[model samples]
Target: MRSLMLASLLTLSAAPALALAQPGKDCHLPGTEESLRCLRLAVPLDHHAPGAALSLHVTVAPALRESARRDPLFLLAGGPGEAGSDLVPLLNTTFRKVRATRDIVLIDQRGTGLSGKLDCKPGKNAETATEDELLAETRACIKGLNKRFNLYTTEQAARDIEVVRAALGYGRINVWGGSYGSRLAQAYSRLYPGSVRSLVLDGVAAPDQVVPAGAHDAQAALDALLKQCADDTVCAAAFPALRSEFDALAARLAKSPQSLTLPDPRTAETTKVEMTSMRFIGTVHNILYSQADSRRLPFLIHSAYQDRWQPFIARSNVSRDFSSEGGPAMPLHLAVVCAEDFPRLTPELLAEDTKGSFLGAPQIMRIGKMCETMSVPAVPYKEPAVIEAPVLLMSGALDPVTPPRRAEAARKYMKNAQHLIVKNGGHIVSPLGCMPRLLRTFLDQPGAPLKAECLNEIPAPTFQLNSAGPQP
Candidate 1:
């Protein structure tokens, strides 16, 4: 689910067929009412390839009922590594109101899904691998994929969307992007202003703002945990020195890491997770994505300090699993972020984002290092052509990444926008709270008046930090 909709289509061709009586490939998608169909217009691997053409699959689940169809809403999936077309099941309910008016469109991105995915799993999953086995694995994966793979850049993807827009014959469409998809939405708005009518960016990672780096975001979970403890009579009285306790836990692990043997999902074998400050920080980092898990951060650390390893072990791996489908998504992620976000990083620029952010820096640095070797021709970061469009930006106050401050920072660039700060809501808010209803209303009006009260429906913060578990 690397958020690669054009991963399949764009890598192949750019020559539109003008209407080739439907190509032969079957575009089957379950749980929808329409038949899936596909056709490829050969696109060059290098845009320089003038005549070479490749066909990519483009499938759609037309509006279930003609009575309830509105202009389509294009779903832009997250995961600088997730597949846009593969998110249908995850979104049907959240967008039900909007769906009553239009079809939900899904497109497999270039070099993703069936469009020639960049998945490399056999190496990491094998039972025979030793402690030092990844180098060969990485080598094999690289050589194997150098074959038919083409541009994995967002610029290539933008062009692919133009082809799909023309083929489908839609003059304007509503776009909804979550997390990294939000980045794509911004890019699209800049590149193809005429194509987008309305936009919904959840977990807003705006184009102008620098993505935060370090453990400061994770530190927010610890802060959330402290507040939760203080609010609860039992917790406040029981763990009064929560901050000291957490700091001590980190110090202890940094000095003496526990060798933990846990069940491995890859092969159902026992694997060792040696505790470290970085691992601990990363564990806290995962819970920041959702509110439910962030609550568990306190309990996880509290348990870890008492020498009960289970809780900490569990929380450690959540972000990794959330980021991947138990496979190799890191490389493609590098291709995108290395190109779009942090390329040509100045030391001062990196420091600016990391300042006071405990959890943000590590993640940002991790991305930066990974991106160093895989840099592509950079695309110019452009501002949205029209800030006139009513935009709704959502953020969780306690969210580790894309926190309220980050959301507010993005708001400054918008000429007209509503900034909804959910007291304790985590990263993803579109599918929850008053967001669904507000979104429905927004789309219903098209380019109409304002409605600020709907945001009132969001539940107030009753902050809690439960123990998060090891990630996948």
Candidate 2:
């Protein structure tokens, strides 16, 4: 069944490439099987300074039709460190309808992808590393970088997008950004309104909302999941003590971190890991990103409370490692957070937000310590201005990081925009059920009424009652 669904999604016919205004070569993006055109544009390292320049990697997935639309869709990646080109598979599947009539353009942000990526060694395991050890690793990463971190801010990346647009000879392109990319898309629209015909922001990170504020939001998501399980007959009967079990497990781990040996999820080699309370909660938080993985939470917690650590450890390892693969480059991620989001966070605000939350103040404070070594000054927080372009905002009701409230806050500043909240969706709902078709409809006629009734048909996530999965 899964294979059939994938075959259906990949059914779009590819046509011969159209003649480009600028030079480019045929290449394959990392995540997709389709051939695409790749190009590199060199921009000044510092837009203000007259010195060295770095080449930005750009990939163009041409439309399936010979005569495509004049303006293409530019996809901005999340993480503030993720490469836009890395999102090809997602666009190829979810936005295939949009790709049928319009070209899709992806540019690797300055400090990520094949661009001048700030490569750094992965930090020691958070569960095992001491505070000093983590801080030392951060310092080493900073000392190893050759370029200035401050120059890679979102504002600068937005300017680079404009330059690429002109070079490619595109006029008033459509923009789609997810997560941090949603924030970047907004920045681009604000900076170059005339160049954008429409905007689609999924899982919005409002300009005024600091990155560390997610602690409270994550707590809310966990609470929602627990409440959902409680409401379900199968789940409630199977795990009647789910909430208390989770709380007791957290308290136990907090008092004494557990050390256990388990086979690696991928290699199946025995390995020892320290399961700290923060790590346990953090793993659960990460798993909540996908509704499928979330369904297994009740079972996972129940098993762990019964001292069956293998199921939790193996699943958590896979979840953590898989999410990090081709994800935000750590150095660039730090550069952006340290320069843009970290300074806005204060101890008072962190404490206030994290009070009574499972994800306490530790994670935010750790980031704060890393930011102390950064040379770049913080970019002052400013409310995003009203964008005149036609805008479509999407959010998942259960998003732990960027909740529906963030999209609600951003809608107030838009002159022409519509917000869609997916009742059963988690993070980044643009690619979910009925969303791809909705995207095509919106891009074709931004001001027209969206046929969004299909969103209401998306069923709520089912809980995993046992190893056999949800009762049929």
Candidate 3:
């Protein structure tokens, strides 16, 4: 009886033939099978104003076998600004077993990817910009955007997912969302629970988690890196006063910005770049995303303190994202962050959250203020999603961004779920050792115990004692 009801819900009164978007030979990831289909969906930019529409980019990689399951799996990307379809190659590779039976779907959300991407270029001298100067740039960004910025909220994105699901004629979907994508997955489940068959949240971000509060998590990750260096005999011996050295370097940079010719890692051409406290912190935050990257921190910090700028600059350049159009759309990031998280962050909240943290709250608080100034409406806060569908929650034990606590908090609301913590992992937990098999097992049999003991085999990143990195 339940199955029949679900089928009825999935097969909603069909959309008009004229409204149905068509699939054609479009985007494909490198090494993806030529058989994959690409689609361009036209969803409303503002649901209230049906006349205003936006074109969203989507790609579907069908099941490998002829006898495939009817239900498909939708993969959501992180970064409120991240292109959802970017995960296609990774999904195609990592979830190959699941793809043998289930089609994998990817939808670039309304404001990201080819879906009317909202790229904004802030002033070039952002590292030295005053609060007023930054605000002026933000206003200029708002003036430059062509679309209705207000409609790009998370709730609206959730609605867009439903439209895509209905357009493609999927009766049910299993969702896997990482980082910020996890939050969107929950929103979709809350709004359309019946459409979801199962849920997997990697780097789970609970609904109540204000975006700026993540500063604390980043600080903690840096602290963990410091502590690890302290505990490692080789590392401690190499840099006995690591923390003090870092403090001195930060203080020095804060007082006087250093300008150097940075050798482009890709091209040997030297480029002049300025290093300030803000720039250093920003670079550090990006590096902390992966344990492999964090392994370079101790060495990089020691080098920086000694005024050896080449290695530090080269390492910093590794995280740079260059695009034909500025970068991943910042307007989309602003739209989502302002509407969802920024409104809740008060001055008191900032003080309380950032206290004792090495990374100060200035950058995030400034963003929060930007959102406030732009007058982005707040989506009513809700309790964590109470999902009836079986869920798999994953987190990296060492993740500085979305820590294990987030998964633990989200686990409470899921009726049937399992939480897995990768001991040596960073922000992304699923891609680590033995985790792919565990994910496959969960998809094959939701609520079943995973044979994931192999996760223990993965070890912490070997600390680099010198320029040679970890010796074989």
Q: Best lDDT goes to which candidate?
A: 2
Judge candidate 3 against the unseen true structure and give its global Cα lDDT, from 0 to 1.
Answer: 0.76
**Which lDDT value does model 2 have at 332?**
80
Candidate 2, residues 143-166: lDDT per residue as tens digits?
777567788898888888876776
Q: Is candidate 1 or candidate 2 better by lDDT?
A: 2
lDDT of each: 0.60, 0.79, 0.76
Model 3 stretches with alpha carbons more than 4 Å out: 1-19, 30-35, 121-139, 259-272, 318-327, 372-374
Q: Compute each candidate's TM-score over C-alphas.
A: 0.80, 0.90, 0.89
RMSD (Cα, Å) for all candidates, in order, is 5.5, 6.6, 4.2
Runs off by more than 4 Å, candidate 2: 1-22, 123-135, 319-325, 467-472
Q: For candidate 3, lDDT tens digit of each residue in 84-148?
A: 66676776567777878888888888878777787665456453354466567776767766556
Ranking by lDDT: 2, 3, 1
TM-score rank, highest first? 2, 3, 1
423 Cα displacement, candidate 3 (Å): 1.0
Candidate 2: how large is its RMSD?
6.6
Worst 10 residues of 3 by lDDT: 1-10
TM-score top scorer: 2
